[model samples]
Target chain A: MSENSTYAEITEAIRAHDSFILLSHIRPDGDAIGSQLALGHALEAMGKTVHYINEDGLPDNLSFMAESQRIQTPPAEPLDVQVCIALDCATKPRLGENALHAASKAKLWINIDHHISNPAYGDLNHIDSTSPATGQILYQLIKSADMPLPDATRDAIYVAVSTDTGSFQYSNTTAATYEMAADLVRRGLDVGTINAQIYDSNPYRKIELLRSLLNTLQLENDGKVAHWELPYSVKEEYNLKPEDSEDQIDLIRGIDGVVAAAFFEELEDGKIRVSLRAKDDTFNACETAQLFGGGGHARAAGIRMAGPISDAREKVLAAISNAIS
Target chain B: MSENSTYAEITEAIRAHDSFILLSHIRPDGDAIGSQLALGHALEAMGKTVHYINEDGLPDNLSFMAESQRIQTPPAEPLDVQVCIALDCATKPRLGENALHAASKAKLWINIDHHISNPAYGDLNHIDSTSPATGQILYQLIKSADMPLPDATRDAIYVAVSTDTGSFQYSNTTAATYEMAADLVRRGLDVGTINAQIYDSNPYRKIELLRSLLNTLQLENDGKVAHWELPYSVKEEYNLKPEDSEDQIDLIRGIDGVVAAAFFEELEDGKIRVSLRAKDDTFNACETAQLFGGGGHARAAGIRMAGPISDAREKVLAAISNAIS
Candidate 1:
């Protein structure tokens, strides 16, 4: 009836719901986990039976999310959730294997997201693309419910908003994001400690993996494209995991001459998982990724190609070259 | 003489000295300028006549040093100073032209530095290699003298100490560094503001220059060595000074496989100045710099080679290869 449902209607639905389940997208990013956990904690504070579940395993870095240890694989039994809430997922399919099926059976599906491409899949969708993250929407929801957020919930929300905005540095950051950050800071959140834990803590093995990757770097297209490949043997030799190599592509992209940087990791299936980063606005790594059936943002993106690392690298470079020209 | 002079003796000498001059090393770094200004402020507090001078012009990034505008070039007039304080010079020659003659003419020469190679060329040398920066030594000197350090002085000292220790991440940092940092933090030094100003703030032109540099990146030796060259025309095109390009070499060195990274800037003097950075403990960039009669720390170093850019690049790569081998 309303252009956008009133806060009162949303509150009424939340109160009427008996059982709530919160879900995030596959390969959950910080915003995904942060929003899921924060909203779940807020609901639990209201004496609601809240279950925070994810189909994909939690990223090791975002393991500090609230009730993170309690997040089990999707229950085998059919869920009877009165309300299903999805955080940070643009499409229903992005809820991955478990939550997608559960959402279909729920009495009412509520989608909370900040993605511009959100499909409004839920019966009650609160999609504010201007918000830095879905966690920002959850903050307002908690306030509307008149529930006091605990420090843990606040920390979860902080991580969600902070990381989504690149610690309040990326182009996505808005004045409202700073207002939210200032409010979070006033609530005695240790921003420095949180930043150090999230962004600065690098293990020795990860540094070694970086060293190994730097050893195989190549420049193409007159040094505009920087590419590197890390073999499975090197990862095994260094005792490094796939997650440990995260952000290595961004580091390469940070080089002064690099407009685009690609890092290829040979998967066990003989496929190569490629990560791409664009340092300039003139190029969009995401568009290149989309060409390979992958999608992401303009500056950062990735795709997986089933082939040898060399073949994958060549294909990605050709795409980038064509795009740039 | 006492095993260690008491606070009273130091205070008496500072109070008694009328004409005080401060000198830092040639190719002065942040620590050198910071130490000189912090000590100058403390000396001025004691009603001493002070003049801060450097031979080479201040690097633009470090132009925020206290009273930096008041710094004078080497004077042709003879100096008859009662007290001459050399802040961060490792050797007398390192003081450059400003204090070359005055250092000999001064009635009392006091050396305050943190360089391990300090020659102790002063009548009273307070060289503590264990300290993080010369500013740390200056902090101790002021505290030992029982002098009240102003907020500005405290801020400058914090900058010096922090920058020299790579924001407390470098190997040179010690337990005392944290203790000093804590003391400064307690004095209401806004670290976030300082860090944002020093590390985060980059001019638009500098960004453009960085973009240009990234366009010329070259990787070799299995990507263990990364190199980029910026001609004088490019710098002029971007309206960038040499100081604006200070961090370019380190950015290249941070590439995944790059054990060594170099940036060759063609100077107006028909010579190419090479800035080098080495990551692993096994490779020392300073050793490579020494091949061209230049010197620096293990991780970062520089050299000036007179030749065409291509020839100089080849020579530098050959020398670095030799050093690593």
Candidate 2:
């Protein structure tokens, strides 16, 4: 069976379905939540009942998004739905055990995502690794399927792509991404207010986190590799959530003459979570990460390894240095 | 005479002139230099002779831009040209004395800019304050006037808008901004590489400056106002250039619940330079700046006043607090 599902085929399935439960990954980012809302609201507008569930529920930072409160944690009981759709989750397990149980009653499963590593786990799947964000895929799917474009869908789509692409500054951003933004703005998206909410409103703890991260910054491999570590102590001191450190690695990554930037954090599990970003394909972040049982895209990757923070740092730094040299 | 010049009028003027001189404001930013190159390259592609001049010359960061080397400081002698066009400068004096002398031979002046404060000093002026950046104006002018869009013009336009609009995150960015970016990408723009140069390449000195600034950060007036100071000694200690501190105020300004952010710097001349940003119209930065004989938009403004940096901080912070109250 072919893994890919066309927009028309998905649309037909959607049209046939009377009810739906939508789910995204744990610690949902804008893309994860935005994708669900974008498609969920469109379905709701068409008189289809919809349940928007996530493992972590809505994030405080994303509460400013219009109609964001609709996204809720998995209910105590299962959702009696005809179809279950996973948005932006690369793997089924990422949807979390609670969310999976909540959607267990649905007979049909649909998976739509942009992660390259995503397996076609759903009975019907639309996995487009070429797309920068799943929000974009939903935008196209709804448009092609003649699905109703509600105001929530419009705003959610903008937030989804804008956050994932680093406000269109990342390499994955394409011409289609901008065209979609233009169309959204043309349809009365208040970009100024929305962007301010998405970007400008930051918690004070986030700045403290940056300061702490910068304090630990180091340059290795003749300055080709720049890295910093966050001990578990600092995380407790700053009272930082997972989102507080979001995109903080970009500061080191942006340093001139730096080819690769790595962030090592001591997790509560006594393991180190390492995030790596390469400036170009030459460094191959994924390749370096794979040495430690981690994997990701060429330019960006993630890993988890046993740590007494220093031990993990030594191994990761050496791997990165070897790759750079 | 009416200050506004239509695209047709500018087109006719360009057709009539053979030799031209292009200039932008001193301490030339991306918009300033990018505007000059964009229009200058377009004219050159049309078989018109053009000289691209800036008073202070190019900054180290912008040197990565294609053909950026062409933007040189004024020559010892003025060049004979039919027209002098100033791009992205709010006023004539800001172009610097040397640049004005170099273009003195030109009989006609054309001032095309997006600054709302521009006084329209040119013999022919096309000022659309509604546009977010002068680069956007150039893009539209080139298109409407049927000017050749050379590779330099294409790339220059993107840099100009992207830099000035904070990579299209600023409130001024409109639907047309995204549309223009999409068009440029479609026309063979390598946004990934270009954006990396524009955004990703930051000098280590800039990060040091951030650390220094963060050290002095303070929240006042019940956390509605966030302010910081940069002593001249720190600037000298870091061997910092002015560009090193660019956009650092954004850190404090992004804090949650901060209605305003102020940056106080002790200039080498002993004057205190104050940059103020209001989160919204509730605190009008321009009105506060005007009290110190400075002016700008409601949301962002600047002032240079007598200093002992502390005195300037007290005065500005008081004004901000008063406005918020």
Candidate 3:
């Protein structure tokens, strides 16, 4: 086992177990999928039976990862592996029910993540809040373990780090992020190709949906907050899939003088899905999301509520107003 | 002098001079401003009197750089400097007449740039086409001279590198780009704050103009081309200055299924300003811009036209159709 790994115990467990299963959060993002696939490839190289599983499956945007096909959406049969490792999920609930049950069959549960708010819920937890992405932490572990960082591992980690750090544009990016990115490029990651596919390859339908959403843009509290509502009907009208609305909140947040931005999606079951993005803790997205039984980082957070979008809009705006005022 | 610098003679000239004038291209961008300011400060540290000159002066957004106050817009006095350096301007015409006459008055004329198309219209030229931004090359020069790089220099270089590289998201970004950015961040550049002000601080008027522009979006040749025409009237109608329409073309270029995008703006003189953006040289933006006597990089390019908005739009679309066909 590598000495640099804070979780040498986790590596020892991996060595002891001949088989393993990897799981990530529901509605898997780049960090979740990248970490899962990177770790899975490393373990598989050791002749271990590695199953990379996600409950909600891969999002449409991250389809470019080299090992994307390896990500399974919870196979029909129950898992029976010796060791289970959860990557990027902050809590058991984040894994959703079925993936949790499948992973529970394993004797050892290892959790690895980089979220500041992680609860460290696993038989062995190695959470480095300082890391901008879980794949970053995994990179160090792979380097320390003397594991071969084949192109697949490097590509997956590149996706994880770039998306998590907004292509190294976010505040979380450090000297280490750039330092690591340089190493990944040397290890056969085509930075340009990966960036183009992950970011620039938007389907036309998404822009069509965006056209209508931008029309719905409204400002509140003296333009300190910007938001738009997307009813379930808009999705049906535009033939939009779930991922079509991804990052639409940025359009609102990118507007000048907007301290906070929110995206409201009306679910079919008379429920509303709200994602909040704030410039900083002054707006407190996490606290606002917590009021609705959802949570996330201070800059970005979300919640689900049983109400009409109009009602949710009224409520969330009030919360944001209170947070900032 | 740094062994890495090809223009050691340029540095020698700098060390030999007591008074200098630095000129950048018209409608100066962050690179023009940043390189000029960084080098100007370095020259001033050597107790040289330096005048940073630009025809149109600094963009409103980069007011954060410490030396912005020193940027002069076509100062009344003629140049009396011992040495003159052109920063980031590719050709004499790029200096827009006034600065060229000013720069020509110096005893020695030097050109420092990263453009491949530079004509080397100076007594000494230092052109590194492989370097993504002129600032990247200048950093080595500053380091070689053993000049003190204060926060101002670091921030200015960051602006130059980041804006030219599209915040390090462009294809030109390499291991060295990140390496240099890391060094800058360590040298007191607040990457997050600087990035937010330079990028995230768009005035609401721009989005207002974008709203109307998106409404005008139309697809041609099976959506291979996406375009919108902004009759210069919109600027006056929206109470917008010229710079407000900057980066507006990206909104059209960012749309999916568009191989090439164009923004047709009617100039005050009835001629149109045509800017073309394409994914690759196969759609050749420079070639398209050149069709109307405009020139720029392969990916992004611009030109001014002598025709009605409708005629230029039709002609450009036909040319784009021909180029891709």
Q: Write the per-residue lDDT of candidate 3 for residues B253-272, one digit (tens) a residue.
A: 77776879999888888888
A219: Cα error in model 2, Å:
1.4
Order the candidate numbers by lDDT, best to worst.
2, 3, 1
lDDT of 2: 0.90
iRMSD value for model 2? 1.3
Per-model TM-score versus the true fold: 0.56, 0.93, 0.91
> What is the Cα-based lDDT of residue B47 in candidate 1?
74
RMSD of model 1, in Å? 11.1
Name the 10 consecutive residues with the lowest summed lDDT in model 3 chain B: B1-10
lDDT of 1 by residue, B13-64 (tens): 6777788878998877878888877888877787778888787857666766
lDDT of 3 by residue, A1-325 (tens): 1112355666777888887889998888888999998888888888889988889888877877887888878866678788888899888789978787777679887888887677877778888878889999999888877776777888899888888877677777888888888888777677678887888776767767777787888999899999988988888888887777877787678677899999999988979999999865468898999998999887788899978888899988999899899
- Greater TM-score among 1 and 3 belongs to 3
Error of 2 at A199 (Å): 0.3
In model 3, residue pairs whose N, Cα or C atoms come closer than 3 Å (at least 3 residues apart or on different chains), thus clashing, are none
Per-residue lDDT of candidate 1, residues A211-281 (tens digit): 56766777787767878888877877887765788766655565555678888998777888888887667
DockQ of each: 0.05, 0.73, 0.59
Residue A170 accuracy (lDDT) in model 3: 70
